[model samples]
Target: MRELAGRQDDEGHGRVLERAAEAIEQASGREVIPGGDGELAGELRYALAADVVLGATYTGTLPELHPGERLALVAVCALAAAMPGCVLGDLERELTLLAGELDQAVAAGRAATAAAASRA
Candidate 1:
């Protein structure tokens, strides 16, 4: 089972994920299987769509979570959102490193886009 990069074994990272998962499940009224969707993707998509529609971050849709816990929840939701019609376990394992790189790309793109928009 491949773990996320920069996840130290002694840092209680797994506990963070576990708490986040429980919070997500409780708030969404859906089961969150780490490597499975269980229709949780639909809920996440809906939340994101709602965010876009409202032009605001909807924190109430999820329980109040610490920053680290929120990150874990976001990561788990991201994995679930991308799992549709794919082998969840394999994808999670295979994309471990690629995901980190993609995160960087995503952050860079966001910064670049925001900068360009500001200049325009």
Candidate 2:
């Protein structure tokens, strides 16, 4: 949480990291999927939701994670930090594709208009 706060770009994924971190610390390695070979957004949401539920479960519910499990949790958190950039990059690609499609559509419409004008 302190590490996230000290970050210069603390938003988006950062918010998730801080929130997820709070839950991961209390969750077993198996309980948290981190990215789970799935979409970052979905995985992050799941981890956060699970965290909240587990947090509310009761006292002593979150026992100490084994050293290996703890390592996995740390890895999950680290991967989450990178997920935001990957998601943003995918969105940019989609936007670029959409723009190209729109350009083609506009060009076709202009050509149609010109053709109709010549006939008239």
Candidate 3:
């Protein structure tokens, strides 16, 4: 059961990374330059802010989260920090994806706890 939970967390983290990459790519139109200067800095800042806001909203909506969910959220924020651009469409998608993942994690955690309690 522990292993199963671990796998779920790992998968969730991977999804967050994957979605971040997709959002970044979409925002930059498949163009990601190296280093943080000028345009890069601006884009990075936008992405980081978006991530922070989205994560805060998620935590506010679901205050009761497991350690794994919190870790996943942090990973998502890190990924967002690496993203770029402030396109409204991409930002909306990013927020939507983050919220959806958070919801899924919370639901899974609740289900797991309920199942464990039932067994006990």
Candidate 4:
């Protein structure tokens, strides 16, 4: 769990990611295995992150958000967007942190899935 601190965009993401993680963890009351395109889900995220970063940052054309901050911004924006009517004016600082949290969750989830598959 590497923390991306001191760099811009890694701000309020921690809180949002924590919330997402909580939601996910709580939802795990049943260990029902998911079927259909699990790898697609993971690949889609990478594609989505790329799309968001490119669209929001205009293919790195816009000189807005620092040199390495677009990805975090995109992640926070995605999380906030996913939850309808989520207010983001408050958690403006932890955006990158949330992104990192998401990265961790995704990684952990994939690892668990792979391990389960191996045992199958």
The lDDT leader among the candidates is: 3
lDDT per residue as tens, model 2, 1-120: 334223414244344445666544433233224334424455555655544222323343442222233333344444433443433356456434544553454355345445655666
Model 1 scores what on Cα lDDT? 0.39
- What TM-score against the true fold does each predicted structure earn? 0.32, 0.27, 0.31, 0.28
Candidates sorted on TM-score, descending: 1, 3, 4, 2
- Tens-digit lDDT track for model 3 on 1-120? 222223333444333334444554443443333332313354444543434213224333332334454444455444444333323235557645654664564466456556666666
lDDT values, one for every candidate:
0.39, 0.41, 0.42, 0.36
What's model 1's lDDT at 107? 56
Looking at model 4, how many pairs of residues clash? 16
Q: Which lDDT tens digits does candidate 4 get at residues 1-120?
A: 112222124334333333333333322212112331212233333433433334323234432233334444454435533322112323323434544665664455445445655666
In model 1, the runs with Cα more than 4 Å from the true position are 1-38, 50-80, 83-87, 117-120
* Among all candidates shown, the one with the greatest TM-score: 1
Question: Which RMSD does model 2 reach against the true structure?
Answer: 20.6
lDDT of 1 by residue, 16-113 (tens): 33433344344333332355543445444554232221222323233323234334435544543443423345645644544564365445534544
Cα deviation at 11, candidate 4, in Å, is: 38
Off by over 4 Å in 3: 1-89
